[model samples]
Target: MPDDTAKPERKRQARGEKRIEELLDAAAEVFAERGYKAAGTNEIARRAGASPGTLYQFFQNKEAIAEALMARYVVRLRAAHGEAFDPAVAELPLEEMLDRIIDPVVAFDRANPGFYALLADPALSPELASAKKPAQKLMFQRLDQILERRAPDLPAEQRTRTAEVAVHLFRGLLPLIMTATEAELPVLVAETKEVLFSYLSPRIDLEATPQHNRRTLTPEEAARKAAHIAMRSNVTTDDVLTAIHEARAEHVRAVENVLDRDHPREDRR
Candidate 1:
């Protein structure tokens, strides 16, 4: 016998999910316009075209709403990263690469003003702060990967530092770009690209050489790549780095053993 209530229950669940999306969309606009402290639940409900009781059913408070919005955006951001950080993107000249990568971030910011508003706010709650870290970390990791591709001979430590500095510079200027007047907006954005290019070109645009044998990644670069792969698992980067080093040590010993068999041993006179 078919359960008569199954279809109605699924329809109700779908409605609830749709209603939740509406609330989050309304909260995004209100948060951008009025800020978190100023954005009230009643105003959010009004903008969503729902009653206060409807919003209360889904969210306990404004903070919960903000956290939920942030969670949604973090997912969007990871999707953006997938496109922006494609390997082919890294193969482009740095100028075109900047456009490909930076445009998505800027577009995402404009589309969801509330996310940056949360980022710019100095008084953000710890919960909301933690919710945004995945987005931040993915950006950092991808930036480092791009540098690894463009400058395969660069030391891992230096490449990591450059990636860190570039992220900070872009983030520091982002709120300015987001809040700029119409005339100033394009100028500021162009200047921002100029600044990044100026900083990156010196590092990435070294003279080509056959010395590297077609410019493949060096040992350090390969290790960095391995560590990046390991990072996707549930482990700390430090542990991954340590494991990489130990593996390298074993590889070196194996190579030495092969050399000992292939070559005559040197004797002290």
Candidate 2:
């Protein structure tokens, strides 16, 4: 109810469960500060202010702690995601809808920085790694469902594609958001909202018109725009082009689809 669907009030009420959460909170901070390869159970226990024996009472090893943290994150994210993607939200103003959705996501990033750390961890076992794919898939499915309702006139393929891009943007933005200073945080968060509004309004905000939805960019300006996007994404420009080249055909087609939909209306004006 506090913008993040039922984060508390269940799954962690008992004394033992509360201790487990305390340990996890410490581990989350540790994992965020140090990569999985560099983190140790002793350090985690120290961070939790528990003896090594106490830590081992609940978790067998560092990997076990990481797995428990991942499992808990999966549950919490699923709950928040369900509310964010609720059909009722589709009736709200576009800005309000974005807030309902984005708030939970930003909260998740701020609270569980370790989730991103473990996501990149090469040492995750097959089970731990496999758990992530389903969660990510669900996120995309829910997002696409909202898009389907909001932009009911758009082609199914286009709607799905838009959801994919939006999810990728969400993933890219979190790392940058996680690094913002307390003073810079609000400004950065507002820019994130602006980015989403601009990307989405042209397609879904039915009140928008071609003349006003987005500004046109010259070829040079578009290149600069792409560079700016890559900067915000926290990825090197060379790395982004390498990824683009790896999926050249698909990337080209995706770009063409976007241009076809958003460019034509401007020309007719």
lDDT of 2 by residue, 115-222 (tens): 878864657678777866666677789988998887789999878866766565455455556777677667666666656666666667657553335553322233
- Per-residue lDDT of model 1, residues 1-269, tens digit only: 99999999999999999999999999999999988878899999999999999999999988899889988988888888888888787788777888899888887887789887776565778887787777668888999998998889999987886676566546645655677667766766675565566556656667633222333333333333333333333333343233233333543344334333432234100
> Which segments of candidate 2 are over 4 A away from where they belong?
1-18, 120-123, 210-213, 216-235, 238-249, 252-269
* Clash count, one per candidate: 0, 0
Please report, as a residue range, the 10-residue window in candidate 2 with the lowest summed lDDT: 239-248
TM-score of each: 0.74, 0.72
Q: What lDDT is reached at residue 115 by model 2?
A: 82
| Ten contiguous residues minimizing lDDT sum, candidate 1 | 260-269
Each prediction's whole-model lDDT (CA)? 0.70, 0.67
Model 1 TM-score is 0.74
